[model samples]
Target chain A: MLKLISSQIVSMNDIEEEILDRKNRKKSTNMILCEKVIGQILEEITLSEYDLIICTGEGELGQTYSFFSSLASKDHARPIFFQNSLHNSTLGSVSLQIPNIHLGISASNGFISYETGIEMALASSSTKPVIIVGIDAYPKELLEVKERIYGNEIKLKSGACGALFLKDSTSELFKSHKGRVLTDICFNTHCEAPTSREVFPANGLEDILRKLSQNHTNFTVNRPGGDSIVYSFES
Target chain B: MNPVDTISITGHGLISPAGIGLDALWEKCLSNNSVIKNGLGVIPKSDFSKVTQFVENSKWCKSIPKVKSKALYYSLFSIMSAIDSAKWIELNKTDTIVIGTTTGNLTSWEDSLMSYSLGDDKDQTIESIREQSLGQLSVEIKKTLAFTGKVLITSSACSASTQAITLAYQQLSSKRSVRAIVGGVEELGKLTIRGFGSLKLLTEDNCKPFDQNRTGINLSEGGAFFTLERNSDSPYLLRDGSTVLDSYHMTSPHPEGKGYQKSIHETLELSGLTKESISLIHAHGTGSFHNDQSEGFALNAIFGNQVPVISTKGVHGHALAASGAFELGIILKVLETQLIPPSSALVEQDQEIDLLLPRKPLEGKVTNILKATLGFGGVNSSFIVSRRDDA
Candidate 1:
């Protein structure tokens, strides 16, 4: 058995808190969201207790294109910047801030970043107090598609960052915590977006947080497909 | 430590320069054909390097439906073939799908970028953007298969598929899902070609793994997938696996494969197996100088001369993330036949390295085999597969 100890969501519109402002740190929009997510829940889950860190993304497009494309440019590329730009670079930020977790991993299976994060988190739960992070900027163009189809003006964040601290369900911490919870996260690749709800959440993680807060026993979030990744929750 | 969970690999499918389907992959491995050919005549020449040609329209690609893009065609073709071989007698919504690729749809994205740079229509750029990201590949796969189950993608460079397989086995071990479709793919593209060529990592000669005068890698395109059904009637069990990041360098590996040693050590501990029981080892022999040295030192330090090592890249070229999954298909064949195939394209083994590359096939019962890969971003991954019937 596994349980989520704490969950945090950060969006472009909402920064979780003041992240470590660094003068030399080559920041990425994806990393910014990750910083905010980890910052919000930094104290909730003991950093040293975590042995595994799994992150998912669209890919490390931010650093790859910006730094790698012109690696031989006149400006001269910094090896540290290039090193921190890989897909798993954000996990490095997780280490800088937390510094306790040993193994940090990044999983990129495409748009299902959020769902995939949970699946991997569940798999590594035996290594108790695992941190699963999902961060990506949605296609700002996706908003255009939504508008062109629905003809409704909506404010959608460009991207989102979410983190869930998980531990074995049989663990003592899981038994003690009475916080909001997520379970049975079923990803339906075959289904279409949820037509049942006219009102929508900001993004993937936001939708999950909304359902948890609203205390909805059952609901679906629209993904690449109509309700492609559907998960049942208990509050 | 607890006993190894031993996740079973009931079925596997692959499409590589070796060939398509399990039988073809096995046959190619058993044969002495060198899949790594000079790509100067076939694929577009790289302006940066002499090694530009690669496997184009491989014999396997002919069986699949033709698509405009190689990435889409190969990913879809390999995945479908895998499920078919699994006889997936049943695919439940509870089953999870996970695939990894080093560069997904990158070739098409490069073309899109070029057209836009050449003043192609803005709509053309937008059309390309739609399919540029790795997500586009999965969307096409999901839409075509109408698979509603949750899908996960992983990219840790060359070790992406092995990491994905690690996750899949963990999912089954946790009893969170009934089955996991675990695999990875890589398609040849100008971006990778030009990119690697720019770094002088592309080899014009047939790649010789662990050879004395070995050059860099030969980039090939292909994919391999396996159906990891729990408690199934499968011979091979995914005994255990691990991933460790060096944070050392993006393109270069750790000098001593420190993180790689940790990954292998942890995985062996998890499987509760020692070097003696291990029958053979399949390495991520990219035929590069530094990579082989680093990996060789790690293997030598771990199992010493007790394990006979082999690299399948000489047979299929380096398929990036697909190599891990592709190599597993070959490992299944190795276990099935109890024969370790020769390391293809080996003329002179690197005497500096302390590992053995078989010049001829070695015959014996392989009760347990380990498959390992070292990827960019300083990612090192390794997993063991065991026979379920083993005592």
Candidate 2:
């Protein structure tokens, strides 16, 4: 079994909405927002030892593959970007930063993509650590669709992406007494509820954290029709 | 390890060049009749003309109702046929509907491209059908089957269906659910056509597997589904199945067939069986020179030349992600009838390859058989199935 040793969510590091307004940036692209988060996360952690890495996305239209592809090689002299880039280039880019890494990508349209990445991290035969990233930025022209799904009129143009380094619970990579507990993850494809509620993807992760903080006991949160994330205490 | 002594294939639906029903296709296979030919020439009310040029000379094209788009037509038909087969059980008896499709209405993209080139109206654009993405497919399936269990859609390229089958088996074996409708669907589209063309792997004629003169693969479209149950009276059973990643190449197989052999060996080992016991091997013979040569080498190295091997690609053409499930449906039919289909287009065999390329359909008491498939991203999978009576 695999466990997450380290996890990070990249968001607008220092750039405020006021800064964007001052710059007169009219379009909101989640890819750029993800770039900010990725920049911050990379600075804080090292992913050199992991065996497998995955990058998932809902941002940076058409730039998804290239953004990751550019990170494939660490060489600063020249940057290589190709058209029709692969779906998992984010992971590939990370792999370039840490050579000898197995990489994959799952951009399927829902929470299952998240669950799938975690499943691979947990199930991989590699004894080394694995990094899983979920990044999505606001779609510019498709704001209405995103708004309908996310359910808010707030002008938070910047999107955020998070990363987790998963390993076996027994692995030496994770520092003792400093870790996130993953309780259970379930994906419901055919949800039966007549009127499905707006269960944001973040709710899945947040619920596990909130449950631990409040009841100090196990709790369950349904993502409804996709993957549900959870965290439990290391009892 | 899950010991599948009780799981069985209770029901299934098939739509191939042989026609809409499983029995119809089975009868054709039993009679050793070829449903594949050059072309249907003129199919009525079909968007067949829209993509007919893809398989112009190929005789077998799995016909679904003419939807506004071809890809959507195939997926909708497969789902309907699966729901129809699931009808064998009472409504709401089982709620799990898992679909495996690689090209999720990709034909929509192809049509949209054509509309763009022809300067068609934006109102007439194929974007309307783009909602038929893989995610939305699950929603549609849930509505169709009225199923209440989990619905999973897998799009792992060619291994899509095999993974679906394995997932379904896991769900049932864990006692989470007793029944599942699992299969795959794929349709011909310009994107795939252009991709394969760029790869220079498209065959100008019917696909000829294992033949020394085999040129390339013909891209075909269709859907196949099997209704599996933990306990049933079905004649066939899934003995064991496993998947392994090559981690070697993104697009090509390991020259030595290491991953393929590993997957097959592990499957046989898990099934507690030997290669000699396998009555036949349904190979992933797409008529591509590399695919046939590599697969032939793997089968030869493992099972040797004794076991008879056959390919259905010649009949159904290469259905991409749907090939594995379609092949599974065919294998189930063979086990039920105790006869194997003949080599449709195979004439001369490569002496370097050690597989039995029989000219006529072989009849035997095939108690156990193996079906192997390798897909893009080094996804290799094999399934070992046993006859119910054998158990």
Candidate 3:
């Protein structure tokens, strides 16, 4: 089983402010939401070594790959990245700085896209820690739609990219102890109202995991609310 | 395992230059003719005209309010077709809507570029176009259809819609309580045209797929959608689907078509069917030298000379994200009618490839069919659909 070891939340305020500080910016959204969200997370995972890096968001790896290509002054870009821009490029970008890294991309849509990507990362290897980044700053137009959905008075705040460093219990990192799957997620997309109107947060994620670590057991039940909707079980 | 709960393709609606209805599209398919020509428009304005005649002919065009962007038109037109085909009522605000596109409103981008070059306040133009492009289309579709379900708008260059289809299949097969409306939509825009032009990949004339004289692909705009159900009275059954990342390149396929080969094998494997069971193959023959050569090599490797192969781009032009779904719709028609549509408008055939190309509609019972595609960003997908009669 894989356990989320440590989670890091880097608000766009830090690095984005850095990138914006350099350029005389006129573009309404200076956040470079995609670049900052993807780049900053890459920066966080630079120290640790991992078997694979998985990036999930909306869109292909072209722009993300190019950012890494320029950062790494390789004489020629990897044909693999140039051809397919495999999933590892996300990690490869940082791996260029980190070395001996393999990465893969899982660009899914909406919230589940991020969740599924995390699930994959956790399942990849029990011993190695996988970095998962889920950061989506609303697109310009989508911002307006979010505004409409949230209401005119409310502005959809840019989403923060949440990076979780996940490792399997079997890894040497956790050899002395057993780690268990914290959340078994399945989506209920058939609500009568929009999820925005119906979701309740799963605040117990951390506490439940801690309790399971002590008990080394399993429990399952249906719960509503939190960042996503579904049943949660802990052992 | 009797009829292991297959994904139901309850409804789909398509409006191409061929016509507004399935019958109309079938007529064009039977005639082996395409209605797409270079479009007539002002922004990124081209005299080349890859317009779908049905778009010009449909009442939907007259009903839609004039919008600044053409992407909205394509989005709306395809939505209407999908709604009509699916005959589905409004979702409880929880159904998932996934759409794919390469150039979301390229016309607007073209306008922005032209305006920016002229030192105009491109802010509003850029903002407006970007809004209506991909996410905007999903919002509009949600608003128009009054859908309350979650909306997922994917734009993964060429693999956009295929990803949508693949995701939808995974969700349903995973036993998730979800219904997905998945497909791709693309309207030709100057950005893509100019981009392809910059890359020297667009053909000056209509594309000729799988031909030795294949020049390059022609960019066009079209949208096709499938309303997939976990269980329902869909006209056909989508037995299995799969997506494989070539991890190869961003722009070109592996010269050997290894990615495509992997996708085919996985798709067939997922469907629990052998290649010998495939009655027909809908290939992603973009008429480009590289795509044709790579796809040709892949087909030869998989089916040898026996399986009949067809590429619709010769008639429909290359529809970007929607190409795979468009080809799937054609396969559905073939399955329903048991008639092999004529491989449209190919001027020459690649002699090195050993496969049958139907010059005219052929009568044959096809229980299972394969539709394969290779898109930009090294995303390749193949879907296996079993005829409803098979169930």
TM-scores, all models, native as reference: 0.83, 0.72, 0.70
Across B288-318, the per-residue lDDT of candidate 3 in tens digits comes to 8888888888888889978888887777677
Q: How far is candidate 1 from the true structure (C-alpha RMSD, Å)?
A: 5.8
Which structure is stronger by DockQ: 2 or 3? 2
For candidate 2, write residues A112-216 as lDDT tens digits.
444545544443333455555554443343333334443342222333445555555675456552655554444443333223543323223333444655756
What would the per-residue lDDT of candidate 1 be over residues B1-391, giving only the tens digit for each residue? 1244456887776667655566766776677466667832122223111111112233222232223456566566666566667786555677877887766777666555445434454654546644545666776665555565666777777888988888788878877777889898887765566666766787898788889989888888777788887666678888768877665655788878977888888888878898788889999998889899998899999889668898877777888878899888888888888888987778898888888778888898788899888887678888999876643
> Candidate 3 DockQ category?
incorrect
Q: After superposing candidate 3 on the true structure, give the runs of residues whose Cα lies further than 4 Å from its correct spot.
A: A1-235, B1-3, B36-68, B108-110, B113-119, B126-133, B233-235, B389-391
Better by lDDT, candidate 2 or 1: 1
lDDT of residue A150 for candidate 2: 36
lDDT per prediction?
A: 0.67, 0.56, 0.55
Question: What are the TM values for chain B, all candidates?
Answer: 0.90, 0.85, 0.87
TM-score of predicted structure 3: 0.70
lDDT (Cα, 0-100) at B364 in candidate 2:
80
At residue A228, candidate 3 shows an lDDT of: 37
Q: What is the TM-score of chain A in candidate 2?
A: 0.59
What order do you get sorting by DockQ, best first? 1, 2, 3
Q: Which 10 consecutive positions of candidate 2 chain A have the poorest summed lDDT?
A: A75-84
Residues forming the 10-long window of minimal summed lDDT in candidate 2 chain B:
B56-65
